[model samples]
Target: MKVALFGLGYVGCVSAGCFARAGHDVYGVDVNPVKVEILRSGKSPIVEKDVGELIAAAVEAGRLHATTSASEAVHATQVSLICVGTPSHPNGSLDLRYIYRVAEEIGAALRHRDAYHVVVIRSTVMPGTAAEVARILETQTGRKQGEGFGVVVNPEFLREGSAVSDFVEPPFTLLGGEHERALDVVAQLYADVDAPIVRAETRVAEMVKYANNVYHAAKITFANEVGNVCKALGIDSHKVMEIFCMDEKLNVSAAYLKPGFAFGGSCLPKDLRALTFRAKDLDIPVPMLESLIASNALQIRRVVDQLLRWKARKLGFLGLSFKGGTDDLRESPIVEVVETMIGKGYDVRIYDANVSLARLFGANKEYIEKEIPHIERLMCKTMDEVLEHADVIVIGNRSSEFAAALGRLRPEQRALDLVRLLDEPPESERYEGICW
Candidate 1:
């Protein structure tokens, strides 16, 4: 396979070197003559581990070529990989001038060629960028996306320190495009590499890069805040984190990563509040820690606001507990929502299999009688009674039975699912999700 890689900067140089090393004929295109001359002399244009050797070997083996001309690079290759830089503006918006320029150059080159060319975006861009690139190609070449050219978002996940290994041994190869033929081209380019090729929506592929980087930044900031509090208390931050990471079932794994309603239970909200309060008392500002409560409040409010807009007078709750199969209603976020709706003069019917058991013969009976007598007054026995009495059904937790209740909903009744009640969400006019 022949590849035309634009931009000979950090990502460009590393990608060009690695792809060529993997036995592909790589033509690296750049506007800078210095980088081109450097690569032309059988040397890497950038300083990276194992990249210089790869470029040298590939060039010596007559597989790698570098030039300042896009025409030459495009004409020499079957597909183009845009590895251009998308810098930030002063207002923090993405500067896509370089990306658009490369798209134009590739489009102009494709006009003269008869072969269907696939354009792979290897830069870190925001969602909808690939669609815009495809539009640019269409305008320049006077052809539709699948006919003459196609765009596929193949976001790079290379950390600066270990870029060579990262390129060849990524966790997975994510290719996003509607056209299978274009997606297959990008996948085949990584066929020699050891990673699963994930074909997803173009917008999802583009946004995953931002999601990954922002999460990494958050993790680092969280550790720093934790370290600050630990140092002030004369505790070993490293040791605390080491022990924390050892809880593979909950802490260092995909436990609460899914997009759901506000988190509330016996432990998380209480522990997070106490930690943030203590950190504040120590004069160590942990904004990330303190912001969780405020963020959680907003998520709870978002559901209420959306419900109010629908003007649904009678609402049904599928699960009353913060989590399913637990009788504990202490600090459940949905309880607050229920209280708010009742205060707003809305008719509410609640049913939770676990809470019903707690109300009858469980330990939560005394607390339920003393604390939430109003919420307990509205409790129903079965899910069917709640579904029959309400205009909008709200699934507050993953109770498993709530999924079946969704199937039995009447045409007039709409369901607002806070927890994703289905493995694959239902596509219907009456069905809605808090976050999908």
Candidate 2:
């Protein structure tokens, strides 16, 4: 496959070299003549580890070319990758003039030829950016998008020093687009790569890079903040973090990573508050650490606000504890929601089998006896009781029974799911996920 790249910067130089090394004919386009001449002369325009050798070898093998003309590059290649820079403005918005210009150039190049071309947005961009590029293409070429050209947001995950290795062995290959034929063609180009091919909608693909980068930044800041505190307390933060990262079940793995309701439990909320309290007493500032409580409270407020708009007096709760199958109501988020609902004059009925059983002699009994004695009035005998008397059903946990109860809601009744009850949304029209 002949591939054309729109920028001869870091990404374009690395992409052209790697793709050509993988047996694809590559052409790089740039507005700057110096970068174009450097690549054309079989020398890399940018300095990076192992990239120059790959570019040199590909150029010597007659598989790589560079030009200053987008038309020249697009005419000789089957697919065009937008590798241009999206710089930040003073106000922090993306300056996407380069992206729009490259799209227009590709669109104009496609005007003369009737063959369908694939435009890949390999640059990091915001959601709906690919659609804007598609619109620009359609307006410029005077041909509908999906008819003459297809837009795919194929974001790259390469780092600065290890770009070659990252491109050769990415975590996974994401191919997000709407057109089937174009997606297949792009997938075939990566046939020799050893990575799982994840197909998603264009917006999701565009948002993945941002999510990953922000998470990475947060991780680094968290580690540094912990290290600072450890240094102040004469403890080895490295050893602490090394052991912390070894907990693959929860700490370093995919536990608590999904978008859902506010986190509240006996351990998390209590431990977080304790840590922040100690940090503040030590005269140390941990804004990120301190923000957890405020953020959690805000999430609870958001849930209350969503429920307030429902205009239903009778509210049913599937689970009341912080987690499913637990009778410990200590710091449970659903318990807060229920208390708030009761304060707002909504008739609350809760059915948690574990909590009901625990009321006999466990934490539930103690919590009801001391914390909120009124909760005893809200408790119901069975799930059927709540199902029988409520206008809106709220699923607060992932209890196995809650998934099937979604199928039993009446036509006028609705469900608000905090934890995703199923892998996919239920087939009911009245169901709403807090965050999908």
Candidate 3:
């Protein structure tokens, strides 16, 4: 395959070299004569890991060539990948002038060609960018899309320092295209890649790069905040987080990563408050850590608001403890929800198979007594008792016993799942998820 890689910058340089090395004749195009001259001399313009050597090898084998003319590059190649930069303006929005220019150039070059062409947007842009590029092509070429050419969004996930290795072995290949033929052409280009290729909607594919970058930024900020808090306490934050990351089941895993209700338990809320308080006493500011508690409190209030909107007076809780398989009630979030519902003059019944007055002892016992003093009145002997008495059933945890009672729920008796118990949403209209 003959490929024309526009913009001989970081992405374009690496992409052209890698593609050429993969047995494709690559024509590198750039507006800057210096960049073109450097690549034409069998050397990479950018100093990336292993890119210079790869370019030298590709050029030596006559598989890679550099050009200053888009018309020549486009006419010689079947596919053109736009790797131009999308810099930011003063207001922080994308400056797509360069990308638009490339689109016009490609569209102009397509006029001289008779074969169907595949144009891929490998640059990072917001949603609807693919459509905008398509409009530019149709306007320039005097030919309808899918008939003369097709556009696709194939986002690259390469880091700068390790770009060559990252390109050779990517996390995954994501292609977003409206035309089946175009998608197939892009997929076949990466047939040698070892990672999985995901075909998604054009908008979804375009937004994925932004999501990845933001999440990476958030992770760094979170780690730095934790380190600042730990420094004030004379504690080793690295060791603490290292241990914290070891528990893949809960922390640093997909266990609680989903969007759901507020988290409450004996440990999370209590330890977080204690840590933030310690940081406060030390006169160290950790706004991110401080905001966690406020955010959690808001989620609890949101649940109360949702319940009130439903107009359900009698509420039945499937689990009283913070989570399933636990009798501990210290700082449990649902306990706070129940207390709020009771204050609002709503009838509430709690049933936790693990939690019983006889089993409660120490701080756990005292905590429950202070929160819900008339605990004996609210406690139900069996799950059957709670299900029969309430108009709305709130699933507070992922308990196995809750699965058995799902089929027995009546249409009038609404079920609100605080935790996403089912992998997919249940097919019942009466069921609702706190957050989907």
Candidate 4:
């Protein structure tokens, strides 16, 4: 495969050199003449472990070259990887000037080229950036995507210091686009790389980088805050965290990673409230911990807002359980949302594959009867029945069936999703998620 990389910065340089070393013919393109000259002379413009040697070897073997001309690179390569920078603006939004400029250059280059080229975006962009880039390319080149040409968002997860190693052994490789041919071409390029490939829509691929980085940042802040709390309490923070991490069964891990309803269970809500209350009593302000409940409520409010904005009256809810694969309804945060909507006189129905009225005759039944009797009355016999009767649908659980239900929704019927159902949202008249 002949590859053209349209940036000679950190990600671009490493990726070009590494791919060249992997035996693919790689051409590095950049606006900077100095960077192009350095790469053309069998040297890397950016410093990284093993990158300089790798670039030297690939260049010496005649597998790698660099050019300032986008047209030359596009003409010589079957696939082009856009590795341009997307820095932040003053308001913290993405400044996509570089992305748009590089895309226009690529599109203009494609106008003269007859081959069906695959343009892979390896830039850290916002959700809609890939689609925007594709639109720009298509409009400029007078070519249709997935037909005259192809586009994909194959985000790079290479860390700066250990980028070479991360590239060779990535945790996962994500390819995003609707084009099957484009996916295949990109997949085959990294077929030798030892990592699981996750194919999704271009927007999802673009947003995954933001999600990963933000989560990492959140984890660091959370740990530091916990350490601060421990210091205030005269407790050993490291020892606490060490013990906390040991509970992989419940804590410091995937226990909270699943996307479902807003967290409201006896343990989470009650414990969070207790901890915050305790912190208040101690006169120790823990904003991070205190914000957890507020954040959770905000997510719930977002769902409510979506449904209300759509003016959905006959609303159907799939899964009453806090999460699917469980029958526990105690303190389910969605119960509050449902109850609130019911109080406002919206005809609501519910269908939980796991929860049946017959199964809930003990304490659970008594609790529901006393606390949320309206919900029990709204419960439907089947998912199909709920879909048949409702004007809107709310997917609040991570059930496997919810994915299939997305296709079954009518154009006018809105879906307010709390759990991310499809890897990409369906192209429908009405579909929304609280957070995507």
Best by lDDT: 1
TM-scores, all candidates, are 0.98, 0.97, 0.78, 0.80
Give candidate 2 regions above 4 Å deviation: 427-429
A best-first ranking of the candidates according to their TM-score comes to 1, 2, 4, 3
Cα error, candidate 3, residue 350 (Å): 4.5
The digit string of per-residue lDDT tens for model 4 on 19-64 reads: 9878899989999999999998988899999999999999999999
What does candidate 3's lDDT look like per residue over 315-381, in tens digits? 9998878888887777778888988998889999988877764345434666566656755469897
The prediction achieving the highest TM-score against the true structure is 1
Residue-level error in angstroms, candidate 3, position 23: 1.7
- After TM-score superposition, the amount by which residue 128's alpha carbon in candidate 2 deviates from its true location, in angstroms, is 0.8
- Which pairs clash in the backbone of model 4? none
Cα lDDT of candidate 1 equals: 0.93
Distance (Å) between predicted and true CA of 332, model 1? Answer: 0.2
lDDT of 2 at 14: 90
Candidate 1 lDDT, tens digit per residue, 123-241? 99999999999999999999999997779999999999799999999999999999998998889899899999999999999989999999999999999999999999999999999
TM-score result, candidate 3? 0.78
| Candidate 3 segments exceeding 4 Å error | 30-34, 66-75, 89-117, 127-152, 176-182, 198-208, 229-255, 308-316, 346-351, 356-369, 374-393, 403-415, 426-432
* CA lDDT scores, all candidates in order: 0.93, 0.90, 0.88, 0.86
Per-residue C-alpha lDDT of model 2 across residues 1-436, encoded as one tens digit per residue = 9999999889999999989989999988999999989998899989999999999999999999888999998899889999999999999998999999999899989988788799999999999999999999999899888897899989999999999899989999998888988888899888988999998999999999899999999999899889878888889999999999999999999888999899987899989988888888888898988888998999888889889988899999999888887888888999899999999999999999888888886756877778977987888988999999999999998898888889899999999999998898876669988877
